[model samples]
Each structure stands twice: as structure tokens, then as C-alpha cells.
Target: IDEFWDYDEADRLKAIEISHAYRKSRGRSRR
Candidate 1:
């Protein structure tokens, strides 16, 4: 259970990082 939770947390962080980068790129393209 602990391992599973750790994996999930890592995935969530990675997803958030990707989302942030994507938004930044989109914002630049819009301008």
C-alpha cells in the first residue's frame, strides 16, 4: 500500500509538471 501511494504521488507530480509546461507553451503561442 505504501509503495502504491508513493507511485501515485510521483505520477501526480509528473502530471502537474507536464501540465505547467504545456500551459506555458500555449501562453507563448497565443501571444
Candidate 2:
């Protein structure tokens, strides 16, 4: 159960990072 929890946490963080990167790219394009 602990391993699953860790996996989920990592996945969530990775998803957030990807979203952040995408947002930054879009903002840069506006310039």
C-alpha cells in the first residue's frame, strides 16, 4: 500500500510539471 501511495504521488507531481511547462510555452508564444 505504501508503494502504491508513493507511485501515485510521483505521478501527480509529474503531471503538474508537464502542465506547468505547457503553460510556460504558450505564454512565450504570445511574445
Q: Which TM-score value belongs to model 2? A: 0.85
Per residue, candidate 2 scores C-alpha lDDT tens digits across 1-31 of 9999999999999999999999999999987
Model 1: CA > 4 A from native: none
Error of 1 at 29 (Å): 1.1
User: Which run of 10 residues does model 2 get worst, by summed lDDT?
Assistant: 22-31
User: Tens digit of lDDT per residue, candidate 1, span 1-31?
Assistant: 9999999999999999999999999999999
How many angstroms is residue 16 displaced in model 1 relative to the true structure, after the best TM-score fit?
0.3
Backbone clashes counted, model 2:
0
lDDT of each: 1.00, 0.98
- lDDT, residue 23, model 2: 96
lDDT for model 1, please: 1.00
Candidate 2 stretches with Cα past 4 Å from truth are none
